[model samples]
Target: MKKLNYLLIAIFTLGLATSCDSSDPAIIDEDDNQSGTTITKAGLITANETWTADNIYVLSGKVVVNEGVTLTIEPGTIIKGAEGQGSLASALVIDQGGKIMAEGTADKPIIFTSVLDNITVGQKKGSNLTIANVGLWGGVIVLGKAPISVSGDLETKQIEGIPATDSFGQYGGSIANDNSGVLKYISIRHGGITIGSDNEINGLTLGGVGSGTTIDHIEVVANQDDAIEWFGGTVNVTNVVTYAQGDDAIDADEAWSGTLDNALVIMGADSDSALELDGPAGSAATEAGYTIKNVTLKGAGASSVSKYADLRDGLIANLQNILAYDFGPTSVVKVNGADSATELAAGRITFLKWEIVLPAGVTSVSSLITGANAGDDTKFTNNATAITAASAATVGANTAVFSWTYAKSVSAF
Candidate 1:
């Protein structure tokens, strides 16, 4: 009886010790869950909040920053969007009066990827995803109250790739200096989810973003749609890089009067044009156009079908210091529509110092742009005013600025 009582007492003492110890295995397991909080963010962010780098955020659905709210994100933060399709797609949207200050450095760039990616906290790359993985989730969309062209001269217009029922999708106003926010050293990858037929999200959709917004050192990879698109705004971008996109690398439409400086586009397997320039639609065609300089477009060279650039929809652009190389033999810079040709004749749509290295069997620039269709063809070669046979671009995207990018890791440059 004494031995039995001793054994029962020992058991009670051990249980008491285990319960009193704060660092017990069970307690530690419980503390692990509470140590670093994983925030699941969805719906509208009406209050101001700062997302830190230590915490992981999962965007389950459409996450919108409501008006007057500011969402600040720390550098090296990884934001992952859940795998969704149709109306259930996930995206991060900044409403008209909302702001997002996501400022990152070359050493620590902010990454936006998909939840399907196996990247954890503090990791730059994922094991499950690569540059070939496209359309994994939706992309970033920023709407602002800036000038945009509309057929009916409406003060505001609904942005495409979104349902019209979502009133927050509408952008554009008279404020040319409307401020959205800042985005620097940000890399968006594996995005551009398709919502409907011929409607898909872009890597970075700037809808009526104004000059007050600061966007620089941006990189987008493996997007299913255009890497970056500006729908009528004065927001200028610098040091932009796009790789392995499924559509146009850079698409400017709705009379985007912005300037894009120092851009590099490396074509993907299913890519279309390196640059697709479309002016204002219908009666709003008289608005200011866009200007692009110091661009290097590397094509797929006989293995892929993609255009160097396509200028149409009455676009008025001034393209200078462009270097296009390794494109398919038939790929050419074609100008469609009579309005675009008229702009070319008027010197409004002009190309200066454009050096193109065509593929085999494609000789002269004239052979590419035959001008066999309607409208004036001589405007492309008037005294070598436009489409001048010049040397390669002396200045393109500074490769050093993209050292921290995924493209650099894969030697895309």
Candidate 2:
């Protein structure tokens, strides 16, 4: 009887220790995905939070910063996305009314990549992935309350690659100066995961993002879709470098009335164009046009470039001081049909000071631009002037500003 009482007393003492412990419930059998510290962000972030540089964050699936909340990321922080497809795809979404201050200095740019990457803390590049790797995960998405010219002149539209049933997918409002937050010195790589059939997200998607947002010194590498695509809104961007994208390097849609300055586009063979500019789909913001200047568009050698640029959908643009090189003879910048050519003549799509190193045996700079309409042959170039022959290095984007980019480290340019 005395020995049994002693056993009960020992069990009662152990119960007190167990009730006081504060760690997470013990796992039956599990190993940490990564060494040191890893925090998995899943579902929605409902409160203001900060992700410090000391910890690595993993996006489990469809992580969102909910409305009216702010999520700040420290410089040199590394965020990775888990691999999945369809609705299960992982991405960092700053939804409408939410904000993210992802501010990184050039010396310590915030890196967003796939969890499969072998990169660890205090590292910029992983050993396993290369410039050719792509579509490993979904990319970063920023949605804000800004004007968008959608079909039927709707004030809002559902963002692409997201289900319509999701209320968080809606973007656009009347606020032209709406502030989404800041994204600077950020590098997004090996993303563009497919969320649906033939629908892969862009490396950096700005949907109805307003001018109050700050975007600069950004780099996007090896995305399966467009590196950066603006679906309306008036966000001015600066010093952007996109390399090895499977689609257009820069795409503007739905009356994006903003300027893209000092941009560099290193195109891949699967890319449709280096710059794909689209016009308004609705009557609203019909007069709004985009300005693209000081851009350098490079193509893969041989017959790999389908076209230098695709200017269609009645886009209004002021394209000046641009350079393109390393393209094949068949490649040309096209203006769709004659109505678009007439629109070009009316200054809806203006071109100036284009310096192109013509393909081997191809000499005329005007020959590099084409009009698809049988009657509009050569008329598109006739309306424009200052298409000259020159070396790309003499003008166009100052590549030195993009030295902090991962594409530069990999010599992708």
Candidate 3:
């Protein structure tokens, strides 16, 4: 873990170097206008640590829970991430074999946001930031020793957001049922800190997570990148809401074979695709198909971008029971020409019961299908049926579970 510690040490040093900045990056025991103690966390946590609701936690730098360590956060606890970029970004990383017992209930959910946020103790959200504000800090990255379909037949690969020099950033193994622990009813906001060009930390990045881990009732608001990106994980998620994302709302890559059930996506300004689905990179988990169901996508953003699924890499997927509406005129459910067409013919890809309220001047669902290859679009678009907005509301995500989210408070639902 020497190399891993060095990775965090670099971030710690960077935080100290930026303490004189105008934002006045938070330090330990600083009066952040919050109640109780402000526990500043940085670098490696080698032993078990429990964060109670009585105090607030601040991630001053890249705080990593080392292998065999357990970092538990009590419900109603508020944790903030310090502002930084690249190697200096502040984030909470659960390395392979580390466990995070951060289980928050519907009534008292855990909150993860930027240190610049004015929200303090016992508050769900702050007035200083809105859904439009983003990239204030880094987000959560959880890695595990599970199977991933990388280019080589490798046992592990470094997660993308972390620099390659850090060996602790590596994730993946033969542990199909690896236990990383539980994350429920948590809201990650104003994250997706920039790492490099076109590379930013996702709101919640699950790299090679396994089925033994539990992630449910999660809400990501104002994430600068993908709200939740699964890089080759078999862990199923439930009841998620992602709103005001600057990039793709949901993304899955490297043969993530799991189900994302009951999800709600509300795209904001500068957002792109509602779904960016990528297939396996290599031979591993090729037969395992991705399953996503029960989604409500509202493409209400001003920006005319990739408004639908951008399927690529010869994915074998199943998307069902979706209700999408209010998209721009240019958006389409894109498929990569012949590869997706071939997959559809081979029964590797399927779509079921998609209901969309077509934008004005579009009278049919067939107009929504587009791809570099002409033949595939027709077949893929056949699953979609046009419906009225009134009937469209009856389908997709159970908004009741997202009552604790900041999105709900702002009526983003």
Candidate 4:
């Protein structure tokens, strides 16, 4: 028995040695040059290289994206969070200048899920996967050198919480044309919740990104925090979905100037607001220069809530052409603030051609749109040609000017 144990130990050591080949660039080189590198274990994959899943690839630490490189993840690749045990772990971090091209097809989307043992046949279970579930397993953070509001001198402001002296978090140095690659047909499930409240990360956090960033056709499922949080970026996105997130489905703050179109958020029953926008009230200026259109938010909870908008101390929001349904009895669209007169005069919460379908005991649409110039219609639009009771098209189509051929049933949570 002693000899057998010794043989097993020898085999294990040999496997470890093989996995730790210093010559392989993916495992050893932090610069992310993958000319002659081979992936053996959980480590960073340089940009412009293809990564295929051998087993379940667990990211034990931060995954950095070097400049001028593109990280291409093949279809059906499953990236898992580390066991975490007792410490925080970040699954993937795309630094400023690096690009991630995780392009998956509809048939086989890239899945990032938890590492649980129990298996259920049909029920969806809560993921043990989170930033704080173990430790600081932060979600993907993308930084760029685009213009960002600085609290101090240009030399003193940290980029994405990392010091300016650090190369690992710096990207798009001096050069203006830095392009973060495309992310399409990717599903990030059961993420969010890093170190603690302040450090807790979201499914996808864009910090100081630019218009060159490509974001489309992404889904975030059951995240502990917001599904997507944007902090001062100019990236435009389309065809995004957020499902059962613990906090706001989409939280935008810090002077974000992005565009969101064709968004579908199916909130959890107990979840908070579907959309939240705060501006300088939390950090910088009190104005948002973004555009939101063709959005459908359906759930049993509140439709939308803004902390700064109500306080009249945050950024101004431009919400157009939205469809919200099945908000619970207590749900409402509230805008309260000290400077309510000035904020409303600026069309901060303007509603144009919006429709709302409520249950029996919920508040009326007249009460919701009390002091605003939504459109020609003083009352909330109901059951237009787009949203009929008999057979309805998807929410995505209703928000767009063109009609969609594909039909989907809209149900309350």
- Per-residue lDDT tens digits for candidate 2, residues 125-229, read 889998788998889999988899889999888888777876577788988888889999999999997666646688999999999999999999899889999
TM-score of each: 0.87, 0.88, 0.90, 0.71
For model 3, residues 72-133, the per-residue Cα lDDT tens digits are 99999999999888878889999999999999998889999999998877888888998778
Ranking by TM-score: 3, 2, 1, 4
lDDT: worst 10-residue window of model 1 = 23-32
lDDT of each: 0.79, 0.81, 0.83, 0.55
- How far residue 116's Cα lies from its native spot in candidate 4, in Å, is 2.8
Over the stretch 1-413, how does candidate 4's per-residue lDDT look in tens digits?
75465456556645654676432223421111222112223344453666663333446555566666677787666665544521245457676667888887665566665545121221122334432232223456677765444444131133343434444554322222346778876767666764544455677877667778788777776677777877655678788877767777887755567788888777775457777765532334435567777787776444333111122234566666677765655555544443433455565545555556654454456444332344422322332222332124333324332111011112222
Tell me which of candidates 2 and 3 scores higher on lDDT. 3
Best of the candidates, TM-score: 3
List the pairs of residues colliding in candidate 3.
none
Model 4 steric clash total: 18
Give me candidate 3's TM-score against the actual structure.
Answer: 0.90
Task: Tell me the TM-score of model 2.
Answer: 0.88
Task: Give the top-scoring candidate (lDDT).
Answer: 3
Best of the two (3, 4) by TM-score: 3
Error of 4 at 155 (Å): 8.3
lDDT of 1 by residue, 190-253 (tens): 9998777757789999998989999999999999999999988789999999999999999998
By TM-score, the better pick of 2 and 4 is: 2
